[model samples]
Target: MVTKTEETQLNRLENQVDNGGGGAWEYLCMVRKLKVRRSVKVLKHGLLILNDSKKRSSLGPEEWTLYEQVAVAAMDCQSLEVAKLGGMRFFVLKLMQYVICNLLQDCANALQKKFPESKRVGRLEAMLLEAKGSWGEAEKAYSSLLEDNPFDQVVHKRRVALAKAQGNLTGAIDLLNKYLETFMADHDAWRELAEIYISLQMYKQAAFCYEELILSQPTVPLYHLAYADVLYTLGGIENLLTAKKYYSSTIDLTGGKNTRALFGICLCTSAIAQLSKGRNKEDKDSPDLQSLATAALEKEYKQRASDKLSVFTSGFKSLKVSS
Candidate 1:
């Protein structure tokens, strides 16, 4: 029932929405509410084209030519709304792929000059490209962003993530360390750095980071649980006791339904038992060590036994058991 002019206007509106123009969200909501049916074939083919575009370099010239054919076909559909939606979707998909593949340098530079307000688009494009598999590209993007906006916490975080992803643990650690020096109260950064150190098997460094997190947010159950896990990993009775204390604190804070904290507590108790068992085996006549090992083993066994039936129950029953 729509006229040609109306269709053109609708198409233009859709394009505007796709490009993130003002009122896109309102228009999109209206379109969704309208429930206008679109050609499934057009939608499917557009998605296919977008998918093909993701592996752009993998496609031979002939394959690329075929993709162009599909894209054109998808764009030439009868429904103006469908065509507009499909085109916008295709652009975003391709853009994301280009960013992931580190092919966004040209696009970033072009967009920066042409659309300065969309600097995020350029930066995101470059970051995505770097994230896909090109640390070099990511580093360039971060360096450029840092030069332009030295106080960009987001860019700093991205650089740290990229560095860690690229197996540059030392670089990641150093950057995080510097960030923490300036943002001394950032528990999230400390936790992230601790996780990175744990991944790299740098237990001592991980422990230090965990200590920092605990200092900042001592009441956070996860922080205590994580610190305890790290301490347990480092393998010392003193540390094991410290880990148990943290795990207990976490359990108390979470009201004991935190299965992860419970698991850690169980593991720590078992560890203490194992350590005591080893010591007792070394000196069989040590009654004090034997008594401690037996107590730890019994406590671990009781906790596990209590947990067996609590696993399957849910809702009120689970709450009752947990309480």
Candidate 2:
């Protein structure tokens, strides 16, 4: 039998849903309201549905949001059972609600309680300690984990990331080199190691990394561009000429739409022109070098201008329609 109070609660829920504001938190608030009024049966019935395997498919992002909200609420209310179940669900969600959402401590504590002594939990605890700036503790935890599982990929990646976060570029480089020994096919790792080398003014190492990337995926323009840039940085007549070839390849791969390639071509051509200008003024290649650079600059400028004009025209049409 629906009583007056139940009718009022139903009306409130209907109103909230109709207004498009019935999110996870709002539903949980409604649950709390019912509980405060001693509506245990209704609360338990709703909990049963949320816990049901049969109803899992119907839940979307909002439902997961509710799970997190309820988990925190359970922790606050000292309800271990709810917190345990919520933590398990969150682990299945791959621990997203913890670190990425920025409530690291709460989720970490909840997960630890649910699965104390779990390897994944230990990893997360180490990360959480690192996040909290307890570097000593974090390092100890990472060291212990590594000692236990030397080749654990997840732990290895996290250790490298932790080294980077601690401003230890050399350490990070060493760790990545060790990692690549076992996982040589990780293209992104090679690229990242190259970036670190570039930042550290280690052009030779950066060039080697880009060379590895080129060998692994010869057709990619990005690797060509990077190799060109690094060679340009480590400038000499031979390096400049090699840089020019790579830049030309980059331009070909991208159909001349790449500004970096255009500028690189211009720079290499001018430098080569100067180098060969030491030859007799009548040299064909030296004179043609200037022409090549001029043509590249002019073409790049015109392409960029055309692109900007198209963007402006589209924006103006969009405003006209909206008005």
Model 1 TM-score is 0.53
- The best candidate in terms of lDDT: 2
- lDDT of candidate model 1 versus the reference: 0.60
Estimate TM-scores for all models. Answer: 0.53, 0.61
> Best by TM-score, which number?
2
Taking the tens digit of each residue's C-alpha lDDT, what string does model 1 give over 1-323? 24467566656776675565654333433333443433233233333433555543444443423332333223223213322445778677665444423323433444456567754654665565553566788788778878888877878888887887678889999999998887787777988888888888998898888787778777777788888888888876778767777876777887765666665555555566567755634333233432343344345546776564334334213322121
Candidate 2 lDDT over 215-286, as tens digits, reads 999988999999999999998777888898898788789887677786677677666656665553433343
Tell me the TM-score of model 2. Answer: 0.61
**Model 1 lDDT, residue 153, Cα:** 84
